[model samples]
Target chain A: MAVWLRSLRYAAILLAFTTSAYAESDPIGYVKTHAGAAFVDAGGETLEAFPGLALREGDVIRTGDDGRLGLTLLDNTVMSVGPNAELVVEEYLFRPGEGELGLGVRLLRGTMQFISGVIAKLRPEAVKVRTTTGTIGVRGTRFLVKVED
Target chain B: MAQRSGMHGGNLLLAALVAGLAVSACAPKSWVVLLPNEDGSTGRIIVSGPEGQAEVAEAGTAASLDTAVPETFDVSRGEIDTTFGDALQAQPSPPAVFRLYFELGGTQLTPESAALLQDVLNEVGARPGADLSIVGHTDTAGAAADNEALGLERAHFVRDRIIAAGLKLDRISTESHGEGNLLVPTADDVSEPRNRRVEIVVR
Candidate 1:
């Protein structure tokens, strides 16, 4: 009876793992540069940001007092954030062959630098960056934004 | 009574001047600034707020985000460095793209592209935590479905070579555009060497 219960527990664990894997989406980007204390809040877990950390569509990237982070997306879009920053990737869809392209990000606080990528080049109106007070429409360019407390 | 009223008006003007001076002493707390591209061309951005919209088309120009109306101003270099030093320092290296051409109807790369493979490997080695996207395209010489398969085959051929060079397979994504996305547009059944190519984007 003891061996049978152990086997049943193993099966249950395997099933949970497979189900979670199936539900998760592919990473949209990766953190390429990091300094000090940065964190990524993804899928209800807070992960310490590292150079190779995979970033998902709904991830919220935050930086502490001395933290800084840089990331590059599949569409070649580059974004960087400075200390005390909270930025969320609200939406991202980059299926060019199927005529689907969109990139949206919201900056809740702190500073950021954005460089437009292939998606912005292909469809300029599809990319947007929102702040609490205003929205920015990208036109295949590089820009910097700061949201104070 | 008239003299006292005039003095009161004078005090109000004096207060207004002081407030104006205070406002000009420091930059707006929340703002955005446009920058020139690497190619030295300035692009445009439209900032829309609850009150109104403002367009910034010149490099070094800024717009206030929390203002009643979009207020445009010029940001000096010193101010930019002071405000965005950390964010600018954290900017990642831009992505690089390489085009490798293939021979007609096969996965074999042309002589020039074969020679260029070394550069691609070197690029992959230089960056830390690098990832790659390889997209294959085919000339319009066959059925769309067949071309799609051929494109995938060509992409796989390149991916295999990269993996053989010791890079992990998980970091690379391969896709095929078939003849649908042609570098050099042509009539159906027309063959173009440029269209029979693969684009490798290293990021």
Candidate 2:
């Protein structure tokens, strides 16, 4: 009886984990300008989300040529993703006067420079910038990111 | 006029009391970790919570960067190689080598580089008693001083991640060789991708 009960509890935990993973939102805005091929996991298969494709955090934004991409983050952080650039929003959360906000991104490919704002400054720990090689736990500051092939 | 002056004083006192109380109510639970720059500067102070994760609630409470974060370091001018040589000799082999590539004047590690880190981490985990030595190298780009610091930062970036991943703090050593050391030497005028890298080796 104890074994059965433990198994049930494990199943419930697994369900909760899978549910949270599905909660991520879709891209709200499209790519402003893409010099190279930009692919998106449209529905299931990877489809091209080129110029005019709406973009959001967590969207795989890539540049074929040495191009650039402009993304408007949830907190209105304007991120200019550079060519051969790959970036992802790992997590983003914002809370008002209580001063709690979380911004997390992973830079996979090229370069990205951030200008911190209310969200990033109010709760700097809420912001996390990750890379293939490492991660940057940042606050309200200006910094640049360059990822290579 | 005297009565008005007295009232103003009382109001000011009340305001001050309220502000003090508010600050106390919202003050963040704080902790500080000294993040040394790859360069030789005093380094950065990363204030966070129990897990070293930045607490947004305390972002305002924690101090801002008091001074410039060392963005660059040089091996030739800084005699940094000596520090690294000593560290390498004493350090254990890294479980794996995490390879990185960079763009010109850039400090970001690309996707392919990140994937490489995953493998490196696995290798580190597989081997017990292994320490990591993060050696950074820069291309013969701009000035020697700039490349030196850039290489150091890249090495630090790797070291910090390994620490964050719950590795033993004492198990890792880091060093940066700016533009002074290159895998593919250019003729004083070329930028090579081979040089811009942070290599993770088991000690």
Candidate 3:
């Protein structure tokens, strides 16, 4: 009976730990609105900012004065966009011990720069950045991308 | 006869002497005249003195004494530019002393950050007629456009918060430089807290 009770106790502790850990990675603020042009890390490739490019973990975003931008994933992958860029944060997760880490980014227009980070390293498949071209995957360790029309 | 002959001869000698003295008294005195030579002409001279007459030729031109003299006059002209243009071109300003902060990947205001904002606001409000520009910046973690927008949003957010706390909106303007004006450069793997901030430029 004592052995069974110890097992139950362990399970309860594990449940509590899981719930609390989930709470920490919540976003404090989000991408309100980016004017002109912007860029996002769409799956693995970079998306030029148009209307709704979102932000995700391990995503690096940049904008030019005339509206150019570059987006990079956490692993140092890159995506460059041109003038009047805008981006949005669609989905993101960075909870420890959850065994799951994902990030999503969308580019509206302009330029972008994306660099990979924790999420891309821990869960390579979970990382993605969306752009006008489509969702890009972080296959190579580091890369540069530019989109314009 | 002898006495008469002597008288006649003496009378004749006296007459001759008188006549010679009269001729000497009638002659005019002579004067020496010297004239300066003109052009290539030669000089002529006359001597009335007992010595005799001699003429001297012209000497060469006199030399100037300007090389030995030093300047005595001093003058100053043109004014220095105290306006913004010259100062901006010659010397760009260093980064501001205080900065604005945000919660990680989010816009939520933490108690520590709230207190910091209050301090900045108080510092600003305490001084009247202090026009300020609230510049926002972000780290290299996000996309460039996103970072630019993020920077601008952060700046505007702070501006709104300060205005909500009784500060004048008219006294402040917002500028988002994004990651273009980074305080510290960071590697692709690391997240630098210093670069993720807002600056209050008090003018």
Q: Which candidate leads in lDDT?
A: 1
- Score each candidate by Cα lDDT: 0.89, 0.52, 0.46
List model 2 lDDT by residue over B1-203, tens digit each.
00112236556556556544554543322111122221323322232222233322221122211112212211120111111222112112212335778666767777788777777777766654445567788887688888778888888887787777777765466777787778887876468888888877652
- Name the better of 2 and 3 by DockQ: 2
Deviation in Å, model 1, residue A91 alpha carbon: 0.9
Per-residue lDDT over A1-149 for candidate 2, one digit per residue giving the tens place of the 0 to 100 score: 69999999999998877745543544333343333444554333454654334444455655555455554443445455545666776666654534656777776765554444457656666766665434456655534445454
What would the per-residue lDDT of candidate 1 be over residues B1-203, giving only the tens digit for each residue?
00112235556566556544544765578999998887889999999999899999999899999887889988765456657879988998899999999999999999999999888988888877888999899999999999999999999999999888877787899999999899988999988999999999989
Ranking the candidates on DockQ from highest down gives 1, 2, 3
- For A43-138, candidate 3 gives per-residue lDDT tens digits of 445655432233344444545554443322222223334344455546667653457577666655433434445566677667665554344444
Q: Per-residue lDDT of B1-203 in model 3, one digit per residue for the tens? A: 00112235556556545544543442121111111222334332111122232222222111111112111111111101111111112111111246767765555555677788877777656543334568888887867788888888888888888788676555566778887777888864346677778878543
Better of 1 and 3 by DockQ: 1
Candidate 3: TM-score? 0.30
C-alpha-based local distance difference test score of model 3: 0.46
Indicate the fraction of true inter-chain contacts that candidate 3 also forms: 0.00
Candidate structures ordered by TM-score, highest first: 1, 2, 3
Question: Which residue runs does candidate 3 get wrong by more than 4 Å?
Answer: A1-149, B1-96, B109-111, B188-190
Q: Write the per-residue lDDT of candidate 1 for residues A1-149, one digit (tens) a residue.
A: 69999999999998888757734788899898989999999877788998768888889999999999999999999999999999999999998868999999999999999999989999999999999999999999999999996
Superposed by TM-score, candidate 2 places the C-alpha of residue B24 at a distance from the truth, in angstroms, of 50
Cα shift from native, residue A113, model 3 (Å): 47
